[model samples]
Target: MPQIAIGMPVFNNQETLARSIDSVLQQTYGDFVLIISDDGSTDGTWAICEYYARVDSRVLIFRQEANLRYMNFKFVLDQSQTEFFCWLAGDDYYSCFFLEKCISVLNHDASVVCSVPKCQFTAPAGNLSLAEGTFPIVQDEIDMRVTQYLYCPSDNTRMYGLFRSEVLRDSFPPRGFHAYDWALSAQTLCFGKHQEIDEVLIYREKTKRALYTGAVLRDERGLLKQLFPVFRMSVWLLRQKKFPRRRGVVRALIWLNLVKHMEYVSNVHPDFYERSRFFYTYLKKRL
Candidate 1:
């Protein structure tokens, strides 16, 4: 099996799919398999993917019968048998050395379950800017990692990091409309350590994307469930026996993060704040 398995899930990303695939094919570390899952794109994404697959033996492609979005991510994960795995968004691309450096970090440290690099965001207006790095995860404590992940103001760049495949298998699956990465981050911390490399290795396209739409968001119950996924996540974690020995500490941390998450979301997405606040109130009553 290849040393690393990269999962690229595409859904109507025709404009940038080729560039994203090219970035992976150009990785300095050559001993890796790129699995591109076209999430039922009606556009020319599959055609572009097919071209790359034909030319490069390292590239394999699949197409879902329907658009799965977050669920498509799980398809690639199920196919990987390598030591390390990562999910690359359809529109994002990585630097040439991203794989080489991340693989080296995992090989050198048995305790480290993930290696994340800094992120750079690119906009259609030709503007570029840096995002968060591994600095937020500088501390070694697993509990600290979980709390900081909840409180820290950072994108989900770490979720795209090279991870030990076994830990990925053990962690919780993606859930809810948003912040699935945040939920998974908690699970990863419970399993092992995560190291962040200072260099910016991934470029995220600043696209206004919504993971949920249509009938799902139209229903009040569905919207509420999607808005307050942390509650489901917390209950699941407890059932899985993932909380640390000091259960009270874990509960307190969750409450603290819940409040901070509310504040953070309100500031970042003001329009969604009132709805989130309503769901949070509903969450409190449910708890």
Candidate 2:
């Protein structure tokens, strides 16, 4: 059995799937298995997956009857019986040393359940690099990490971190919605410390197909739908024993982020400012 299992859930990613697979195949750490689940892609994504599987014995490919979104990732995660696991997107690729460094961290530190590397973004315009700031190592204070993950304004980069398979399996599965990754990150904190490595190992490609489209305030109806998950997440957090004991603080933070998110959406997509109406207020008050 491999020491690490990388679950790649893909959907209609034919255009850039090859590069993603190549990045994984060329990893400096070779003791890993790559499981790719094509979520019923109508494109040539499955063909590419098949070719790579034939060439590399480590590559295992599966095809879903329909698109299951986050559940497809669950399918891949369930198949992994390794010490460490990672969820890789079909369009995203990682540096060759990503697994090497991440696996080393987990190997050395038994308390750390996950290791998140710095993220770099590539787009048609240019490249953007995000520094991994001083994120908390919450081995002792798990609640601290949980609160920060719930409220802090961070990218979904942490979601792709190398995770202890047992701890990851114990955490809640991601919701089948827009901000599911955010919720997953929060849930992971309840397991153990989330250690951050300063090196930029992951390369994320920016495109319309990406989940969060700039503040997510495309319109009143759209923004409301996107933000509804926050309420669900708040309830989910409150139910978890490892979450902050102060339920009121959690509730306040959730609403505060909702308002800030709406403002950000309005600023980026100004046309929605007039259309958003009193929907956000209703959501905040209602939730």
Candidate 3:
């Protein structure tokens, strides 16, 4: 079995840190190291991490003096030394065989750079529930799925995935991107292929503050800015003629952004509509 490195960035997640750590420690695949980056957490998160590190040599803990977002996550990932890597959020837990199954796919296919597994979402106050039936089983599938989701606004299927360490290291998430996972997934698809496993290996915690949640939609301007990269990437992919399975979806994505830009201007920034007209025009031409 190849060695795996799991990078986890933690903030003030005292309520779920212990459970997340325990799930990693209990993984059936034992040849793995856990790198925990505490981004200046104010709660008892650090203390809990320290306790686990003291007992388990596999757990390596680091502390960031300030609260950095996904950029800090990239920093910690850079310090890992393993053939495979995956991130587990401070508030999420993984199945004992999560790493094993993902690694198996990578080991089987040299061209595949990542493996995305099915996930279960759970609210802090409620029981864990199945969020979706399955995610894309390959990179082309992810591209198509992402495009459809963008246009129709449905629950996504490609969120929880394990990536090749080198691929992730080469194309780190851009700072200020809404979520590292989105940028990382885009990069992984561009550089290499991906395998989709149907097993629900990750249990995602749906808290108000969780970065992946749709809460950013409340900030219309922020949401539009964040989505710009996804649109940009889609345009690039279309030019490259990659993921032909996703061509239709990509076209829809472009139009979706155009619609969103119009809505934003009509509702919030009517004054800037003239300047933003270029964005809408560009998207319309592509669509």
Candidate 4:
């Protein structure tokens, strides 16, 4: 069995599936299993996976019988989990040393649970831009680390980083909700430290998404759903029993940020602003 496992769950990603696989297979740290789960892709994604598996014994491929829309991410991880594990999105590719650098962090530091790399996102236009910051690596207090995570507007893409397999599984949520990745990271942070490597390793492909498409995955819809959401997040975190109660001051900061977010929304969507004001007024009256 390999010390590391790479789970690639893909569906109709023929345009980038081979690129993603090749990058992982060509990693400097070569002793790992590449598990590909095909979610009934009508495109050439399965053919690509098959070709790679034939060419490289380390590549293991599994295909679904039909287009089941199964939870492919967790499915691949369920197949096997070695000492370390990571999910490589079918559309994203990494630098050759990406694995070597990430595994090195895990190897040297027993205290660190996940080793995330700096990422550069690729726009559909083919332009590349480096992500501004990542989830911080606070070595000591869990609450403090979480505060840093909340305070800093960091990319949640760090969830794709390499992690201790057991820790990852243990941190997995019983059920997922909106902003669940934030919940996952906070839960994992409680267990041990997370280190973000300085090196730029992964090139994440950004999907073109339409605004207000009624997608459940989207965090925002309009003023009704978006109103004072950050403040609510603060309340939930402070009240939660799993972690220590964060400082009350956290809510105030969240409130301030909420104001800024509200302003941005108001400028971009005037109708949303009008609706939010009336809605908030109604709630205030009831209170």
**Predicted candidate 2 versus true structure: per-residue lDDT over 1-287, tens digit per residue:** 99999999999999989999999999999999999999999989999999999999999999999768678978899899998999889989999999999989888888888887887878767867563432555647666666666556355577788999987777655455445566677777777888888878988875543334442433224545554435545566567666666664565556646765675566556688558748877887864
Q: Check candidate 3 and list the clashing pairs.
A: 137-196
Alpha-carbon RMSD to native, per candidate: 4.7, 4.5, 5.7, 5.0
Residue 19 of candidate 3: its Cα lDDT?
94
Candidate 4 per-residue lDDT, tens place, 93-180, comes to 9999989999999999899988988899998788987775455566598777666666554557778889898877776654433344
lDDT: worst 10-residue window of model 1: 211-220
Ranking by TM-score: 2, 1, 4, 3
- For candidate 1, the C-alpha RMSD (Å) to the true structure equals 4.7
Error of 3 at 169 (Å): 1.5
Candidate 2 vs candidate 4: which has greater lDDT?
2
Clash totals for all candidate models: 0, 0, 1, 0
The candidate that achieves the highest lDDT relative to the unseen native structure: 2
Candidate 3 versus the native: TM-score? 0.74
Off by over 4 Å in 2: 131-139, 207-227, 247-252, 260-287
Q: Which stretches of candidate 3 lie over 4 Å from their true place?
A: 132-134, 137-159, 207-253, 259-287
Q: Per the 3 Å backbone cut-off, how many clashing residue pairs does candidate 4 have?
A: 0
The residue-by-residue lDDT of candidate 3 on 1-287, one tens digit each, is 33888889999989999999999999888998999999999889999999999999999999998777666678668879888888888998999899889888889988788787878888858877775523443434656544544454323335456778888876664454433354445545655665678778888875443333343343224545644424544444444433444567657756765665575454555778777788777767867
TM-score of each: 0.82, 0.82, 0.74, 0.79
Per-model lDDT: 0.75, 0.76, 0.69, 0.73
RMSD of 3: 5.7
Model 4 weakest 10-residue run by lDDT: 208-217
lDDT of 1: 0.75
